[model samples]
Target chain A: TQLLEQSPQFLSIQEGENLTVYCNSSSVFSSLQWYRQEPGEGPVLLVTVVTGGEVKKLKRLTFQFGDARKDSSLHITAAQPGDTGLYLCAGPFNFGNEKLTFGTGTRLTIIP
Target chain B: GAGVSQTPSNKVTEKGKYVELRCDPISGHTALYWYRQSLGQGPEFLIYFQGTGAADDSGLPNDRFFAVRPEGSVSTLKIQRTERGDSAVYLCASSLSLAGATQYFGPGTRLTVL
Candidate 1:
């Protein structure tokens, strides 16, 4: 099975600070997706990167896919309390694989 | 149109009992999916349905876990002889199609086995 490991499993930072989470795997994926999840709610898709070395920004959040399509990263600029939640990266092993393999998870707590 | 929705927001069951979880996808979405999320972990894919047929169920942990999408819009996940290890949040998602589609997820049902 393809596995995605995330770094800094838990992070607690004060509001207005900057932080980044990383997702890495040995297997290459056709695409990668980032998601944010809050308590009592399902995860919401933040971004999807299909091209290697692609970078996408969503307001305070920025995402980057590795040049090899085997890793990705999420950077939050000037974090807010609203950003405190679980951040996950997911993707399938290859094309035609509908089931997504998710990263372990990064729990971020922004102290306001 | 509404987002995907799962019934019985929380379920507490005894070990060895059977339970059923239901999901209602967004209006007109033909692809429904089931996933399980444990605390401190991301969602693990359990199954996927394209229309009314299960396109892939390889993620299911064992035979005790079964799911069905009879009408292509709503789905049910059934678990037999639930175990404490089975305790987790069951998530449902739906998309217009399965090929690299963006899936919309439901709040999920928290199932606790004692």
Candidate 2:
């Protein structure tokens, strides 16, 4: 089984602070996706990075995929309370299949 | 368009009992998937269906876990002899088709086994 390890399992920071979370895996994936999940709700898709070394930004949130396709990162600039949630990285081992292997996850709490 | 929808937002059942969770995919999505999320962990894939047939069931933990998508739009996940370890949030996702397609998720059903 392919495994994705996320560092800093939990983070609590004051609002407006910048933070970055990493997702690493020994196995390479065809693509990677970032999702944010709130309490009592399913995960909401944030971004999908299909190319290695690709960088995408959504407002103050920036996502980067490693050149090797085995890792990725999410950086939040000037975090807000609305950003407090569980951040997850997921991908399928094969491009033809839809089953995703998810990362352990990073729980971020922004104190407003 | 309406996103995926699940029924029985919360379920509390005794150990060794049976339970069923239902999911209604988007209006025309043909691919439905089931996943289980535990405390402090990300959602784990459980099953995947393409059309009315199960394309993959490798992620299912055991034979007790079974899922079916009879009509290709709505699906159900059934658990037999549920164990305490089965307590978790069951998530359902749907996509227009497989092959790296984007999936939309439903608010999951929280199942608690006592």
* Strongest candidate by TM-score: 2
Instruction: State the DockQ, from 0 to 1, for candidate 2.
Output: 0.91
lDDT of 2 by residue, B32-112 (tens): 999999999999999999999999999999999999988788899999999999999999999988478898999999999
Q: Note the DockQ of each predicted structure.
A: 0.84, 0.91
Worst 10-residue lDDT window, candidate 2 chain A: A93-102
User: Which pairs clash (backbone N, Cα, C closer than 3 Å) in model 1?
Assistant: none
- Where model 1 places Cα greater than 4 Å from the true spot, the runs are none
In model 2, the runs with Cα more than 4 Å from the true position are none
TM-score of chain B of each: 0.97, 0.97
The prediction achieving the highest lDDT against the true structure is 2
> iRMS values in order, in angstroms?
0.8, 0.7
RMSD, every candidate, angstroms: 0.9, 0.7
